[model samples]
Target: MDTPQRAGHVAVIGRPNVGKSTLTNALVGAKVSIVSPRPQTTRHRLLGIASFPQGQILLVDTPGLHRDQGKSTATAMHRWMNRAARGSLEGVDAAMLVVRAGQWDEADTFAYQALRQAKVPVVLVVNQVDRLKDKTALLPYLAQVSEGREFAAVHPVSALKRKGLEPLVNDVLALLPEQAPLYAEDEITDKSQRFLAGELVREQLMRQLGEELPYATTVEIERFVVDGALLRIGAVIWVERDGQKAIVIGKGGERLREIGAKARQQMEQLFGAKVFLETWVRVREGWSDDEAALRAFGYHD
Candidate 1:
């Protein structure tokens, strides 16, 4: 397919675990963002470019919007969400408000309210239809939202299953104004190699840690050096408390070793080079809420 000369930015904003990252990967036709079942898995604003037949769409996958309690990592993540949303929406040609199909709650309303306040041309993307056994049940909820609103269009899609995405892409491209491509044709994402490597480690850690540890942990790549055929990396995994650190390290450091091996393999595939990854766990007492620590770890306000 001939690449479309026209292009514009499209911001994907939604609440936690609503498949925002999944939809981003699907739309971009690449794994630009790490996907996990856990909420707030995305901590940074990731840019993924989708080159459609009609045009290239720069999809800015923002962190999920949520209320913060001024304590813990959740608050820091919420701040990141606000920062990404407020920063990226300016002068964008279009926006997609992604919400889970069957789970219409107060958080969805908050996301909608924020989008409405942005005053950008918005499209409501109802995602995760695969989870709904009775797909028709979503109609009433859809109708309730559609009434007296200025949504460019409402699209129900399954981001994970790759269903109903073509229409969404078409609608987003149609809304975009004619312009030059914002990024290079070969570029799939805007995050650095180190950032992607750290995220891959974090993704593996999230899966291993499950519900109890995913929210409390933050992975940072301390060192990355390429030596010919081998890529050497050092990363530190930060947890809120000493007990959590023990949990991550596991019995005789077996679990942490497993996590490192899995992440290194994935990093090798991502960089197309052999990887030597070294990871260690650290207990940073309330590091999530500490302004200096958060900033140092790349969680900017």
Candidate 2:
């Protein structure tokens, strides 16, 4: 008897900062998407592929679904994110809805609504279980979240600590159909190196800068040239205003230097090659709200 192989797509839907990206990375066993503490860190629709002996899962990590977004770029960004996440759910064999353990907000409700509207089979992933002091407290929370909806399985896992992930992956893989793998066995993601490098830079900047300032920043890879064991990458950090640029660059360009150094180190580790990274900050003047600018920066579906 031979082992049956299965494979299909799984859309990991959730509000911002619910560990969706982290879970995607953990399941794939690689850094396919960038992660940050800030909301709206994942701007694009990312695919992280996880392979198992019995099957494989192509996880779709979308921009966080936001609710009650107000005027300006923030609203535009949230709408676009919701669009990306909703679009990912279409045609996917299953959906994984990640919500923080013991908490549910309006944004989470928005995400859940999208999942329900999609009519796709859902796996409710209650991430951050490791943060809970009383493990039994999860029982009622799980029951509440699963109420009035059908879940293939309710997995309580910690994307950060890697706890309870093995079972979660097993359940998710089982949700996929019995078909051949969609991507290559060793291929972790379907994104270009340039896009990933840009994401990495954005991730580091978001982590280093923290709060409000990082939201105004977006990364564009201007150049990616490979020479033997050395990789030269030039990235432009786009900000909506001069003050934001100044903040990103920091005093006498110190913050910019640190961002570059940290990003370069990650790049080297990711690509396994010496990296020559050149970063420059520029003011894009409300580009986030500008639909044309957003599309040009690859923010669209």
Candidate 3:
């Protein structure tokens, strides 16, 4: 007898840096979303298509759910991120609430409440289990979290090490309706290569920069030209101030060069083509706070 096929969207939601993007990439078997240690690295809602022999899962990777507190955190960018995170729940067949192993806070609770309000099936994915020092604490923590809340399934998996994901995927697939694949098997994500190129450069900025510098910076792909088998990409790194620009460029342009080199390597690996990436740092002056500027930087929904 032939098994039924199931396919639908699953919203991956969590607070900042809970490995939501990592889990999406792991399930899709590709880097569809850029990852960094910094919070709110994923500013857009992205679709990652994960295929199995019996079913397919369309994963919606969104920005971390966060509160805009005080003057510092209250910016147009922050509001947009919150909206992006909340907006992902719409029409999803299931919601996967990702949380760090051994830790649950107000933000996690808020996300769960939002999912409940949306009335979607919630699957609790406790990510980063490999980092837990005490393995004995896992069962107790799971029991404690499951006491008050209802979850269709709960699985402790390490998104980075790719452990314990088989059962998680199986259970998530069962939640969807029986249907054919929504996207082609070869297609891993809905984002274009041009959009991904900018994200890769921004990922480097987030990783290489220190403190709050990465938050004030963004990458714009000025030119993405396909010349034969090679990709020629030009990126403009926008900073909020002149001092930030100088710091990003570093001494004698070494830092900017390193950022470009690393980003180009990632782009090549993902696009499967040789890439010539050029980057320039420019001052934007409070672009993150200005809604008009945010839209110009591709932050619009």
Candidate 4:
């Protein structure tokens, strides 16, 4: 007799910069979600489909759960991101409470509380274990976080290095009800190519820009056309002020060109086709806080 296939949704919940997107990409075997060192890099809830011989995991990658204080302002974007993270709990078969291996804070507690309220099985994922210098501390840290907490299982993994995922996957699969694969094995994510192209461009923005600029910026795909074996994409990088646009454009537009080049390379790799990506920076004057602007920029439900 063979084990039955299990398929279901798993909400990837965590605080900012805890490697949720990296874990989702590792599981799906593709870069379905964008990641940046900056908090709130993920503004929308996207699904990454990871298929295995025994089961399939539908990962809902969300923005990091953080309070509206500190470096992040209480803008409409922040509110939207928080809503997106919380809304992911609904209809999930299980939840992965992702946190740093050696650190647990109030934000992590807040995420755990949110998952508890969801009433679904929570698998505590202690991510970024590779970065821990003191390996002996791992046991104590794990014990500390797991104390008085209910977790179906706890696994330490390095999503970037693709370490310790097999056991984690097995444990998570066991929690799911037996069913057939929800998506085709070849399918990686629920987002379309157009949306991904915009995200790739935004990923470059998050990677290359300075501290505050990336947060103040958003990308929109104005054009996505398949020209034979190539994809021609036009992306508009929206900024909150004219000064920000000048900074993004940089000296002799070199900065914008570099951003486009890197984004196009990522697009080519992900799409497995040639990509011609053009980017332009435009000022929207406080678009981050304006509800109408956010909706127009494709930040709605």
Candidate 5:
């Protein structure tokens, strides 16, 4: 009797807000990462495993890559994306480069370049096809970008509408070598409960705050204690400046309370237990630039 072989990893690399998290969640049939309309919402590589009748597919949801001007926070996020993308391609069976449909911009060009450099069996996924009025309009752009390059396949999908995903999944599985499951069939994601809870809080904040705050905020779970029926969790929301902290807490603590309540509701749904979540805003001056702070927050390698 020997251990069975396992399927290899599939890295989903793309620019920010291109529906990477949405596609990862859809593939896994669960929410493993926080998704916001804001750019660079995904700060780390989240592994979501999708199990099919044939085999398992491990999806790596990475942070969006973009050029940052002077924002230290954005610079760090881009570094994270580079790290994940490079590391994931090392021995991956295949890679999917997600690009927004109906656009051929600098960001898309950068993404294409990165994928070309990866040298792995790649699939070009044109996401947000639902936004395209004329689907045929995408052909010229796709053909132009893919002219001299080798892509296992080019797929146009709407991650939001769950359109054109089945084919993508089937194609990905076909590329994987015949092997045993890399992860337990029941385990859908590699993220911990604490990480998921923090992400849920951050997602709500991102939705409510919008671009008023950059990706300078981080949520850390200080304490996660389970006492019988209730979960007692304490988290600190770190901001880069006192002004940002003020904005997060808001006047009379109303906004902070609202964020906490919504986060608690989501946590309960995630944990399947009543949650008592306490969140506090702390100004950690220049946390983005501080190497110690970045390492402590699990942003750095």
Candidate 6:
């Protein structure tokens, strides 16, 4: 006799920069989401599907929940990010809250509120345990976080190191419904190659450029041409102002070139074909706040 098949949706939620995206990638066994050290790097609800012999896990990577200050001055982009992350929890079979060791603030607590309201099986994913200097220090923190709410299970993992992921995946799969696979066994991510290409370019910007500039920037793939085994891509890097555009292009165009090179390499690896990438910077002022512009940029729900 064999174990029954199980498949369902699992939304990965957490505060900003708490390793939610990293953990999702680890569990899915592929780079379904682009990562950056910056907060709110993920702009949408992206699905990373991991199919196993007995079960299939649909891991939804959402934007990190922004920390709420006493006063609500959260920008338009922040509002959108929060709405997206919170919205992903609805209708999901399960939810996982990724938090760092010994770091639980209002944001983590806030995440808990959303999960509790969703009335779904919630798993507490304590990520970045590798950062702990003393392993014994983990007990108190773990016990502390576990005090409130009934988590289906608690998993301590290091998303960056890819450690303790097997157990985590197994545990998450057990919570899924006993059903057939939702996606093909070989398919890892639901995002289109074109979207991933633009995301890769934005990732390069976040990794290579100044902190403030990356937030001001967004990548758009204006054209994608495929000819048999070769792919040609033309992308526009949008910034809010001329000074921001200048920062992205750098003094000698060296910065922009570096971004393009790395992003093109990522595109080639993902598409498994020769890729020709062209990137140019343009100013799109106040696009984040403009609903029409945001819709044009594919930020629609």
Q: Quantify all predictions' global Cα lDDT against the true fold.
A: 0.85, 0.87, 0.94, 0.94, 0.82, 0.88
TM match of model 5 to true structure: 0.91
Which pairs of residues collide in model 2? none
Q: Candidate 6: which stretches are off by over 4 Å?
A: 67-72
lDDT of 4: 0.94
- Per residue, candidate 4 scores C-alpha lDDT tens digits across 106-211 of 9999999999999999999999999999999999999999999999999999999999999999999998989999999999999999999999999989999998
Write out the backbone clash pairs for model 6: none
List model 3 lDDT by residue over 1-301, tens digit each: 9999999999999898999999999999999999999888899999999999989999999999876676666898888888888899999999999999999989989888988999999999999999999999999999988899999999999999999999999999999999999898999999999999999999999999997999999899999999999999999999999999999999999999999999999999999999999999999899999999999999987
Write model 1 residue lDDT over 1-301, tens digit each, in one string. 7554678888898888889999999988878799888887888888898986677999988888776556544565566667776677776778898988877778887887777887888999999877888867888878987887779999999998999999888888888887777777788998889999999999988888867778788999999999999999999999999999899999999999999999988888778899999999998887766768888888774
**Candidate 2, run of 10 with poorest lDDT:** 68-77
What is candidate 5's lDDT per residue for 196-289, written digit by digit as tens?
A: 8889889878987858585778889999998999999999999988889888898999889999999998889877899999999998887776
TM per candidate: 0.92, 0.95, 0.98, 0.98, 0.91, 0.97
| Cα-based lDDT at residue 278, candidate 2 | 98
Query: Which pairs of residues collide in model 1?
Result: none
Cα error, candidate 2, residue 80 (Å): 1.7
**Best-to-worst TM-score order:** 3, 4, 6, 2, 1, 5
Q: What's model 3's lDDT at 23?
A: 99
Q: Weakest 10 consecutive residues, lDDT, candidate 5?
A: 68-77
Report the Cα lDDT for candidate 2.
0.87
Candidate 6 residue 8 Cα shift, in angstroms, is 0.4
TM-score attained by model 3: 0.98
Q: Model 3 segments beyond 4 Å from truth?
A: 68-73
The residue-by-residue lDDT of candidate 6 on 131-163, one tens digit each, is 989999898988888996789999898999999
